[model samples]
Target: MALPAPPKANRRAWPALLTLTDDLLEDIFLRVPTPTDLARACVACATFRRIITDRSFLRRFRAVHPPPLLGFVPCWRPGFLPAQPPYPSAPLGLAVADAADFSYSFVREGKWKNSPWIPCDVRQGRVLLKCCRNHGNLLTSPSDVELVVCDPIFRRFVELPPIPDDLVDNRRFDLGHLLAPTAGGEDEVETSFKVICTAANHTTLVAVVYSSVTGHWCTAASRSWTSLSTAVPLPCPGGSSIFDYSQGYFFWMSIWRSSSLMFDPIRMEFSIVQNVPKHSPKFPVVAVGTEGIPEMFILSDDSFHLLHFDIAKGNEPSINEWQLRGTIPLPRNCMFYTTLGAAEGFLFLHAIPSLKDPPDYCLLDTKTCELKKVCGNHQKRFNRVNAFFGFPRSLVK
Candidate 1:
């Protein structure tokens, strides 16, 4: 006779079959890499989300990858270009601030024909690329968008669609992009990037955003004429470009006065954030730093305390407030970092032990104030280089 059934009053092992607690299953899920994969694991248990938390993992993954990078070589060189303020050329800048602290400045490179490249801090782990002035004829338009998206660390690049010429004023070129996930994703999919630009001409200012998911550009809110009166007009608005994918917005320093006046790259907004410089949001330059987390240094030259702009609320005069934070002032010699994205708990920087030549690549730890060298073949190092360092490799999804 066949053996009696194991269930239905005689024997029961159903509880043991599903004995694994939700927390236990969740812990197992976190180990898997990839958003799509993690998502599937999350579906297995409500406990998985609590443990692995899809968006949380993806975000941390984005921050750690630390995107800003430069992988550009112009088709043709420019005749001549200007530097400083209206910085018509390279935006080669070195940042001493992290997401938390917000004071930044663009370092002017000495060489003009070096094909300078600047690292854009958008989408956290992925870099939005920019190159110095190229041949006018080769360039699509005077205000043409000349940025590309590529892996900062790997040197991989992708040229993006040019910005509409009519929208850009050509008087000033201010660009920023925010990386955010779109609604649709099945199994494996490319993450979406939201590119935002604010180009202000003599009397025209337009805000535009590009959706990587839809593969097309869309108009953001219009420029407010109310603030336009007081809004520092071009000619010398030294706004530093920044892209925050986490908050679904891009930011820039619209005007650089005593304190750097900042603007939002997305939603076409502006604000004043004085949270940096010798006080709160103060950043000291450190070496051997990671990309996402940057060590900041308040320079003696710039204002003792610098203010960052925050325009999160959409419409309103950028509040004038400088929250106090600690400051770091390092010897000019030690304050070397790559002008790129922050990641891996440090700021990627370029430093030259001797000022006679270009600086060597180094990493500065933001949290611990540690410096470590990361450049190899220092002699053949990348020229006009910007960085997007520290992001972990596993979290690209």
Candidate 2:
């Protein structure tokens, strides 16, 4: 019968990835190496998008592969420096820089049209900014300002309710930090977030937290600076006073005082960690150590010193102690500038080789001890640049 039509090819013999079950697909996706690849995989089809966008899947993916550092957003400027050539996440970072609104045009709606919004913090693909007059004094107590949290990728924002009058009175807002939803044990993404704004009076240091879930501002913690240490003067608000969030606590370091203020969001308490090496550089950055403890990286004259802080226990009462873990010598001809920030085990440093040469933005891998330049000779100067370290995702609730 016509040679049996040459025996029709069997479609079943070919691989059918689309036919895979949801569980099997998620298992396969978990093995995806980076969030950039994961984001690309999301566009393959509707099925892939559905599975990847699920909150449960995202939580699992983050646990396995932490989000990548996409770029650096200048604190005062309106642009960003994306990860460029040779980096594994270069493509994704470039895509974000091209598509996202770093200028934050969306906040210009209504009464905020002319108000300038300064980025206070960036975490989990969201930017936390404060909207106020150009002449506003951020260090003053009980000021009139609006806090806006936005996802530039999705071009969406929520104006956080103002801090309660009682909480704001006599308090100077000094620092702000953004906390992810999972940080509070919630699985949902983008539907909610928490903002911690720290303020201080001459006598008391106070933290006021605004929760999107509840739509209210509440004082999370407050402690007298004198109680922590009389020698440590009130942390003067400045660009050099850096803060990092690690192990569910917010640590604020005062470079001049050689002390750090630690805030526990859950317990609503503040503790003091004293005796940071006085001789280290002014812009030392903090990151989580391999053992889950907080560590500090100090860029000295010729080497980068790693110090691990731990609670020393005995009959002498518990105290925070810093131990020298290791050091990495700086490459020849390179000189320390200032630390930009730290994220995902990498400390971002801005270094100048010579007084005549252009500066470079470099990344130092805390675990592997690998150092490389990510961006070179950025044209626009910035007093502070915060590392934005997460991939854009669906904002659907």
Candidate 3:
């Protein structure tokens, strides 16, 4: 009792978390391992909520932590397959899935009540969807449909203004992507985005981009398919619903030709990446390399090959050449079916054991080269699934 009475001054000097400045609090919160944990901390007190909700703090946090892959959203149906136990991010993913609206009910309100919206692409917590009559094929042309960009976690959406008639009159919409913001401060990155839609006619391939900053659509690039490249035949954009983004560029494996189409968003240019591997039946999925270069993953019967494209030195201008990096053997008895999607250093694939057996879905960690089965024999329930990945930073707000 005498000793306790002597230490009253020391007890009174102890620091309180609430007394810390916003700057110091943010410094501590940035170390949160996952967005789900951060979301939980947000409700601890009013000060924690205010500091985490700040736009500046959110941007800094994202920079420190890469977005977590929640789950795959089936393109064929309005449902989500949450990552379950055994998956590293399963717990965080399940929380996000429970909180977000994959049904897209927010877009069905008011005048668009009866309209059907199909998920086109998902990037950075935002879903890109197009309103169309047909929902059977994910690769159908979206030339005449209205586009909507929504944050499903927050249940807010913005209906983009129609692309000008002159820009898309006779062209067929091939592929559309929700681009990550490249410039501006945190507010712009959080609120502003661009949608790049590619369309083609008999003679020309045109790219029209709609910017949220401008609230208008403009032609980004237009070139005759013949002039773009000679090594590959005309591209069939409707052939596959698979595309990948890396290093400020978007890539689509040409189904009709032995090449891939590359789009540079910064320069608004289209070029051909020739001499890519011609793996039939299944196309290689592109993932960003550790050094910022692009790498492709090709799946075969027994193993999957990793290929990297590097510059070939010569008198000629720099051209990307695909080089075999390594190969990872698949589990015995598993046969490759088709590539479902790729994101966040993981590739999703469909596999079947035998002709009579049901298909199994697997996820490949590109870095660790570890393959794990996610779901099995549900092909009848969901025809095709595209993985939708992001950190739910906006969930707090």
Best by TM-score: 2
TM-score of each: 0.52, 0.83, 0.80
Candidate 2 local accuracy as lDDT? Answer: 0.70
Q: Candidate 1 local accuracy as lDDT?
A: 0.40
Candidate with maximal lDDT = 2
Better of 1 and 2 by TM-score: 2
> lDDT by residue for model 3 over 247-328, one digit each (tens)?
5667776344467777777778777777777654567777765455678878776777788875222212235555788887
Error of 3 at 245 (Å): 1.5
- By TM-score rank, best first, the candidates go 2, 3, 1
The lDDT values for all models are 0.40, 0.70, 0.69
TM-score (C-alpha) between model 2 and the true structure = 0.83
**Which portions of model 2 show Cα errors greater than 4 Å?**
1-25, 35-51, 109-115, 133-138, 171-173, 177-181, 184-189, 230-241, 311-317, 393-396
Candidate 1 per-residue lDDT over residues 112-141, each given as its tens digit:
344444444433335554554542222222
Q: Residue 345 lDDT in model 3? A: 69
Show the lowest summed lDDT stretch of 10 residues, model 1. Answer: 73-82
Where is model 1 more than 4 Å wrong at Cα? 1-18, 21-23, 29-143, 146-162, 169-190, 224-255, 259-268, 273-297, 301-324, 329-348, 356-358, 380-386, 389-397
lDDT of 3: 0.69
lDDT-wise, the better of 1 and 2 is 2
Pick out the ten consecutive residues of candidate 3 with the lowest summed lDDT.
310-319
* Model 2 poorest 10 in a row by lDDT: 311-320
